[model samples]
Target: MTIGLMLNALGAGVGATTVDATARDTPSASSFGIGAAIWVLISNLIGLAVGAYVAARLSGTSDNTDGTLHGLAVWGTTFLISAVLLGNLVAGIASTAATSASSVLGGVVRGAGSAASAASNVAGPGGLQSATQGMVDRVQRALSGGGSPASMTSDQRNAEMATLATRWVTDGRMTASDRERLNALVAAEYNIPVQEAQQRVQQAEQQAAEAVRRAEETARQAADTAASGAATAGFAIFGIMLLGALAAVFGARRGTRDVLLVRGTGNVR
Candidate 1:
């Protein structure tokens, strides 16, 4: 039984690796296709069959039914040991894969949180509203040809605009007062007309919406791929195990017949 388990593990590992490598090298080849499944089944069947034959021969059973029963005992013992080992291996692999996926997902979530934080910060004390009011007062002075608010540095103006944009994204839609204030700021900063500033704001909003949609789609695809891979692996494991039992029974019958033939020939001699 132990020998059987070892042989099966080695055969399965090699076959799976070979199939995976071939699929990687072939353009458009699927890793979890029928070929891979067939290889796994064949490898397991061959290993179990060899084990069962050895067990029957060692038992010295002349009756086919007796040999078959011995083979079944061998199969059951091997199956139990294999199941325990496979379960441990699977648990370890699942833990590692889950950790990796969680790390990646967490990174994405953190980035999204950062974006949200930036937007929320705009509503805090001494935030976007205050910044926008300061910029507006300066713009009004500049438009009146005062040349005093022009003393405000370019860095200050840029920071104020960035804060307003972050707030706009989080809010999803601008209030009437925010729209008017933003329009005035843009017109003053770029020397553009108010109508052009409004158009620019609308374009920015559309781009933000598209970005959100893309993020959602990417997350969904990752989840689907993980689910499909898990399902395929589970089904393949079950099928290989079932086929292995059938092979063990067949091998025992063959071994028993061979023993009976040898004994009869000896009597004739």
Candidate 2:
């Protein structure tokens, strides 16, 4: 495990040096990522192989099955150790996050308490009344739709918009009369010709529909890409693990072969 970690560190150092020494005018981020992953895999395989070989040798096992079992045990041990290390790292991060969240919650609670303490001041003269007046003015300005409606007050426009919105939400479409009514409302509000207002409304509807279609297409494509990426990652993880196991088995077999060589030289059974 130590040997494997050392190899990993050495590879990391070499990779860092290589990146720093690169003179490429247009370096691709993905290429660097792939290189790092490959290096890490190689380092891990080498470490597992060496560890398994040593374990088998120390067990003094000449049997292939025994050697293989030793290698598997080494692999399992190393995997467990790595998992524990990763778990600890995750736990530390969670702790730090929890700490920060608590701090934020505490600040929010303090602010709420301060607000409660100043409730009398908030209820004092010209406070709530001014805020309410400001909100009403803002609403009037919004309902005015960039200016005062040419033939209607802000309240009338607001009521008309609310009714139109309700109709659309409830029935999802406007009838011919509804279309005419909307066109007249727009024409009256902006003092434009009814024909021009109708054209504008049609254009707005088409643009809105197109925007929705494009959004749906983009979302579907994003989902497909995410699924493809996840599948690839899953398969790659399985393949790398399988290769590491094979490396361990091969190393153990070599260790057993070495044992036979020693036995034959010593003239022992």
Which candidate number would show the highest TM-score if scored against the true structure? 2
Candidate 1's displacement at residue 134, Å, is 22
Worst lDDT window (10 residues) for model 1?
A: 141-150
Judged by lDDT, which candidate is best? Answer: 2
Residue ranges of candidate 2 with Cα displaced over 4 Å: 19-28, 87-151, 155-180, 257-268
Task: Work out the TM-score per prediction.
Answer: 0.52, 0.74
List of clashing residue pairs for candidate 1:
none
Clash number for each model: 0, 0
Residue-wise C-alpha lDDT for candidate 1, range 1-269, written one tens digit per residue: 44445665775566556644545654234644555556556666776788788888888878899989877877788779878989999999999999999999999999999987888686776686787799898776434422222354554445556666777878876788667666666666777898998898778778888998898899999999999999998886777677777888988887774432335745842
TM-score of 1: 0.52
Q: Model 1, residue 190: what's the lDDT?
A: 79
| Alpha carbon lDDT of each predicted model | 0.73, 0.80
RMSD of each: 11.2, 5.2
In Å, residue 10's CA in model 2 sits off its true spot by 1.0
lDDT of 2: 0.80
